[model samples]
Target: MTDFQTAARAATVAMRDVFPATPLLRNAHLSDRFDADIWLKREDLSPVRSYKLRGAFNAMRKRPEVPLYVCASAGNHAQGVAFMCRHFGVNGVIFMPVTTPQQKIQKTRMFGGDAVEIRLTGDYFDDTLRAAQTYCAETKGYFLSPFDDEDVIEGQASVAVEIEEQLGRLPDHIIIPVGGGGLSAGAISYFGNGTQYSFVEPLGGACLRAALKAGRPVKLDKVNTFADGAAVGQIGARTFARLRDVGLANALTIPEDRLCTTMLDMLNVEGIVLEPAGALAVDALKDLGQSIRGRTVVCVTSGGNFDFERLPEVKERAQRFSGVKKYFILRLPQRPGALKDFLGLLGPEDDIARFEYLKKSARNFGSVLIGIETTDAANFATFFAKLDTNGFTYQDITDDEVLAQFLI
Candidate 1:
């Protein structure tokens, strides 16, 4: 075996001592929907609810001399490190953004117990990472990178090892979600050209695609954090090395809002809980269409650390993606019955999700911020026809980020 494969095999064996390999189950729901045989490498079932624990365990296990370890993450990586810290009985310091969800913070603490110290640092990951590194240097702790380190990449390759062993052969295609690229890198290294790969990322976090385009890692000016687990602003340098040669044509960018649809579908239809990032690969199958029909494909369901509190937001996003919900800013006449007249035009399936009166914009008209949700996407067309016939001047502000942020 090649050195990388050998290391991955070792990591796989070591991981068995901690937790059983995550399931590689054929998903009949997805299979019937896509007219293709679909399998899922359920990394979400890992001890930390992510593939992160593999890298954490591998890195820590290789260096028994490093009694102190440190890492910065507001999500799964932090939990993975903390779990491993407790497992190895080592001292760990984890830095997280102050704005991290309380559920995640509490879970990390519960996993680490006394083995880890939690530090709430920066408002952003970049700041938190810097703080953690400086502290590690000063305290002589081994700073564990979430994805940038070679050891971590080697560790993550174990996922492919498990897939191979469980399935007894390579899949025709593997759809992997890319953030900082460690998982993609490791999987590609193990599977190589023997299997086709479809790398999916949130449209806002397509760093691997960007890096491939630039022939090196490049930081994005802005990142969308809706899928915070995969919301990396830049691909890691080491990860880029393994992934740089991947063709841009092989990458798929999933819109942030569209991912919500897949998350909801998985939850409602299959009873599978998936975070936004976890649903990326499944969402991409729609984009792939008939090209993969009849092929044996594996979609890595990356993580399931979704907080139930975000369900409303996820539903809203899914509705928006499906075009069943929209927000509009209407200029209403000063006449007393105008509001009543507008309400009467709505179809039975249409429901007003939000209604707010902003300040008056003109002498005879007032601006009304309204959100409408309907059972069918076609309801918008009928609603707009009624608006036009009634001579109501309105602007669809559903996609207006600035206005939607303030009102919706």
Candidate 2:
């Protein structure tokens, strides 16, 4: 075996003393839908609800004498490290962005118990990471990188180890979510040229794809933080080195909104709860439809620490992406029966989710903001036809990101 495979095997054996291997279960629903044998490597079911724990456990075990540990993360990684710190009886200081969800912060604290100190720092993860590193250097504590360290990469390869043993053989295809590239690198190293691989990334934070295009890791101009767990602006240097040769065609970018639809489908149909990042692999299946048919495919559901409080927002995005929901600003004549005329344009399945006059003081015309939800995406075609036939002046603001952020 190659050196990485040997190290990864050792990590896998060591991990058994910490937590049992996460399940590799055949997903019958997905198999039936795609006409393929589909399996889910349930990293989401890990003790920390993420494959992150494997890296944390392995990294810490390799540094048994370190009195203190420090790291920064928005959620999953922090929880993983905190859980490891508590288990290893080592003091840990975790820094998180101020805007991190309260649910994650609380869970991190619970996992660390008395062994970890939580520090709410920086508005962004970069700033928080800098602060954590600086503190670690000043205090002479071991800094645990979320995905950059060699030990962490080897630890993450344990996922591939479990998959191979559980499946009895390598899968025909494996889809993995990429954020900082740690998981993808580890898995790629473990499997080498033995299996087909695809890397799925959130469109707003596709650092791996950007790196492949540029031939080096580069920071994204901006990243949508909806998939907090996987929305990394830059791929880690060490990870990028390992993933540099990944085929460009095999890298898939999933839109953040379309990802919401997958998240909802897994929840509603299969009764699986997945965070935005966790659903990345499953969502990529749509892009691999013909290639995967009759083939055995494995999708790594990376994490399930979804806060239920975001359910409404998830549903809203799913509806919008599916084309059944839209927001528009209408220019209506301020006259008697004008409101009645617009109401008459509505179809039976079209429901008004929001309606408000932009400027109620207008005398001749009033700007009205309206949100419509329908039963079918095709229904919007008919609805728009009626608007055009009536000569109504309106602008669909659903896709107007700037305006939607301010007005919606």
Candidate 3:
């Protein structure tokens, strides 16, 4: 066995001391839908509800001589490290971006208890990482990198180890979620050339794809924080070094909105509550299409740290992506029977979700903001056709992010 495989196997065995291996369950719903023997590696079921715990435990255990551990994360990694710190009875100072969800922050505290002190700084993970490293330097604490450390990579490879053991055979394909690249790098190291791998990243923060295209890791100009767990401006250099040989062929980027639909589907249909990042692998299954049919495929659902507060946002995005919900701004004539005429355009399935009218006294027309949700996506086409046929003037603002921030 290669050195990495050897270390990863050892990590897998050591992880039993902390928590049992997360389940590798046959997802009948996905299997039937895709015509494949689909399995979900339930990393979301881990003690921290993320595969990050494996890496954090392995990395911290190796440095027992050190009295303290430090790290930065958006959420999952922080929880992982905090859980490990409590497990090992070691002092941990976790640095997290201020934007991290309250659910995660509270959980990390609950896990670490009094053993860990959390400092919230930075607007992104990279900035949080820098602050952590600086604190580590001054305090002489062992800084646990979320993904960049070699030991963490080996630890994360335990996921691959459990998969092979649980399945009793190699899967034809493994679809993995990519954020900082630690888990993907570790899996690649453990599996070698025996299996096909698909790396799925949030479209707004596809650092792995960007790195493959540039032949080096580069910071993205901007990152959408919707998929908070998997959204990072840059991929880890150490993780990228391991992932370099894979190229971009197997990498898939799922749009943030499109991914929301998958999240809602998994929740409503399968009763699986997957966070935005955790659903990355499942969302890629749609794009895999014919390639995975009749074959055994594994999707690593990375984390289930979804806060209930985000449910409305998730539903909104899912509706928009499905084309069944729309927002529009229209110029309605300020005349008798005008409002009634506009109401006549609605089909039986159409429901008005929002209607706000702003009147301009100097003008003959009033600006009206409307949100419509219909039973079928095709209903929008018919609705638009009627609007065009009539004299009503409107602008579709569902996709207009600028106006959405201000009006919708």
Best by TM-score: 2
Rank order by lDDT, top first? Answer: 2, 3, 1
List model 1 lDDT by residue over 283-396, tens digit each: 999999898899999999999999999999999988998999999989999888989999999999999988888966567888998999999999899999999998999999
Question: Cα lDDT of model 3 overall?
Answer: 0.93
What lDDT is obtained when candidate 1 is compared to the true structure?
A: 0.92
lDDT of each: 0.92, 0.95, 0.93
lDDT of 2 by residue, 1-408 (tens): 899999999999998998999999999999999999999999999998999999999999989999999999989999999999999999999999998889999999999999999999999888999999999999999999889899999999999999999999999999999999889999999999999999999999999999999999999999999998899999999999999998799999999999999999999998999999999999999999899999999999999999999999999999999999999999999889999999999999999999998999999999999999999999999999999999899999999999999988
* Candidate 3 segments whose C-alpha is farther than 4 A from its true place: 359-362
Candidate 3 structure, TM-score to reference: 0.98
Report, for all candidates in order, the number of backbone clashes. 0, 0, 0
Worst lDDT run of 10 residues, candidate 2, spans 242-251
- Measured with C-alpha atoms, the lDDT of residue 244 in candidate 2 is 92
Per-residue lDDT for 1-408 in model 3, tens only?
898888898989988987999999999999999999999999999988999999998998888898999888768888999999999999999998898778888999999999999999998777888899999999999999889899999999999999999999789999999998999999999999999999999999999999999999999999998998899889999999999889788999999999999999999999999999999999999999999999999999999999989999999999999999999998998889989999999999999999998556726899999999998999999999999899889999999999999987
Angstrom error of the Cα, residue 11, model 2: value is 1.0
What C-alpha RMSD separates each model from the true structure? 1.2, 0.8, 1.1
